[model samples]
Target: MSVLVRTEGRETAAGAIRPQAGLSTASRVAAVTVLTSLPVFLPGAANGLICAELGWSPVRMGAVLAVYWLASLSGAFVSRRAALPPVVERTLSIALFATCLGLLTAAVAPAVGLWISSAVGGYAYGYTQPHTNALLMRRCAPRLRAFAFGLKQAAVPTATLLASVAMPMLAGAGGWRLVFAGTAVLCGAGGVFLVRQGMRHGIRPGHSGARHPAATRDRGAPLRVGTFLVALSCAGFFGAMVGNGLGGFLVLALTTRGVSLSAAGAVATAGAALNIAVRLAMGWLVGRVPQVAWAALTGLFLTGAAGTALLTRPGLGAITVGALLAYGGGWGWAGLLHYAIALPYAGQEQRATAYSQMGVSLGAATGPLMCGLLFQLGPDAAWWALTAAGSAAGACVLVARGHVGPRPDAGVSPARRRPRDSPRPA
Candidate 1:
């Protein structure tokens, strides 16, 4: 009897899996960032205006947001087996879905209808993120991974800045509905462009046969346990808690402290801008800094931000600037650590699942609700909760570092590892 065995590391006739030279790493990261940023920046402000105009209660607004998160969590699971071809396909799909939903929501202008559209858009957006990470990991060289991930992270703030500038203009000129319609048009056009670029480069969905099934299969179990999971989850919780939870309330907190609403908004915007800057900086820094050290530094910054809020009554100018820099840098630092540490362990096959797990945990549903409950206790409660969460997340990184030494195989080409010889955590 003759048997056929499939050998790993054999690329399809096209070539070895590598990031397209034409699409430089900077461009690839920028593309992913732009795609992801639109949704993140637009929603909160848009939702608030819609709720007010519709006379919806906090509960109704909260439900709309919660539904979006739930959809994102669901999409994360679906992407694991969905045969996503490349980063471009993922971006195009997300953009198409989001734009269509945005346009439909604008046209319909019904509360229930908008909510449903938001859910669909949110899920599609969530689906795109893991694929972005996978593309960076598999296609880009290992040396560029940290910097690429940071560049991708920077997109969140960049989009937020764009939204901040655009949303108000659209809202003032034609109302909030016009803003949605405009976003839809912009995102759809962007998606179409990405699709064309992807085709030009011959990138499409499905594995390029560069991965070994055995190694891919083994990745599942350790990814579920071990230090990686712990660190990943902790980072997820901390990042989401700050990004979604505290971020939502920052303006309100500043207003309470006697700053005017406009000033508070500006401060918040400044922080977001700082976040983008820090993300870019951290990406370069991650290559030189240990992941544990980044986590620890992020924790210290978070603690100091909380202390500033708690221990001192600095003038609004000082307070806002301090909070903006500290929180923005902290979130950026934590995000970089999470991506750099977790990406290696995920391997090629299970990359989407591993990346999505972080999104699932960090999504708006879990993190914000817990922080909201704490906020209900009092403003101080929220501050304390954030401080504690940051501390805990930092500590977990430290603990995980103690258990897991640097992978001896780190930086070696993935192609070099024999299927049976791949490292498995004890």
Candidate 2:
């Protein structure tokens, strides 16, 4: 329970912590990518079928999502405790178990059973994210952190791509229940792999000298609250609204506008593919550019994409391609920059809390619900609404930049410093 502060050869530049060398950064990165990605694959493909069978309306579905996010927020709060190791490990195990159980329950149960199962799964997944991020960041080298994070982020789309192909085929032959059961098996396998990997590598569960007192005392600097929070909220709202909600719905919208299902699928696939590419590109960009400038650029691209979707005629292939590029680029870039920049403002002690609060306050669930309702209004209305929201988000970023000014010396706070003397986990 003792937190040791080691300050040997640690340096901060541009608001990031440079992790010292000693860990098997590659293995840790690989572990994070696989474990974090497995849970996301099922929801993207199965949500529609589950909703249809359950007879849940958009509002109800939104509420369900809200409950899941609330659970995630709760997990984030729990991670703030100094005794985070066992708590995290137990939480991960419970989450994986719940997710598997939920999937099995959905396969066999009626509407109420499915809903309850979904909620349980969501809560478990929410609890797991912060711990995973914290563990990865603390253990990785500073120079490789962004790239490592990008690699981890890429797991999402990769999983989704696999799910898109596999889930449909499984559902066709074995019913939705079978699909759920299969997903459960995958999650269970992933959880077991992570646990075994951690144990085999001798990686302990608790803080690894990163939360020591001297580091805390030296790095306890106050952050710019008003500007940072506003920007953070904007990024979260835009991210959840477009990236999570609208991206899922875009195919239907395109099909409604006379695009063939295959074409619509192609567009969606293209966007997702571009998302993976842009995320890696953005990770590299963040290390080279001003983080705020990157944020502004992301907002601009997103706003432009929204506008294009709103103003253009539906049949133009070139325009569609351009819009997807913009949409994918903005989302991929903004997500990386948002987390990278926001980490410095929060300090290490409160980073998890800050992320959770933003998730809640931004109404992560509500964004998609609102988009769904807008779809019911009219496709054009939905497009315009997204455009307007994107514009607002972009404007907020500009306003926030004015208020906070430039961050010339932004680097990781000492409070979140990693130990210089600790041996790298093999």
RMSD of every candidate to native, in Å, equals 6.4, 6.9
TM-score of 1: 0.78
Task: Write candidate 1's Cα lDDT for 1-426 as tens digits.
Answer: 000112234323223434343136545556545644454446566766777788887667666666667766676666655544423454544556564665557446656656756577667756666666655554455445566667776776676677778777778888777766676776676666666655555423463755544345554443334454455456565656655665667777778777899988888787777777777766666545544344544454465345434413457756765566445644666446545444544444334234534454354576567656766776667766666665565565555444444454332122322222225544
User: Which candidate number has the best lDDT?
Assistant: 1
Give the count of colliding residue pairs in each prediction: 2, 8
- Evaluated with TM-score, which candidate comes out highest? 1
lDDT of 2 by residue, 1-426 (tens): 111112212324423544443134433444434433444445556667767877766566556555555555555445444233532344455566677777677667746545666567655554555554554444445445555556556665666677787778888787777877777776677667656644554334453633433224435333234554556456556655555555546777777777788887877787778777766666555545534343544554465446336434556475476457545644564435434443443234234334534453244565566668787987667666666666655665555444443344433322222222211122
The segments of candidate 2 whose C-alpha lies over 4 angstroms from its true place after superposition are: 1-44, 47-83, 86-91, 197-226, 288-312, 342-353, 360-363, 400-426
In terms of lDDT, the poorest run of 10 residues in model 2 is 1-10
lDDT of predicted model 1: 0.56
- Model 1 misplacement above 4 A: 1-29, 81-91, 203-224, 288-318, 349-363, 406-426
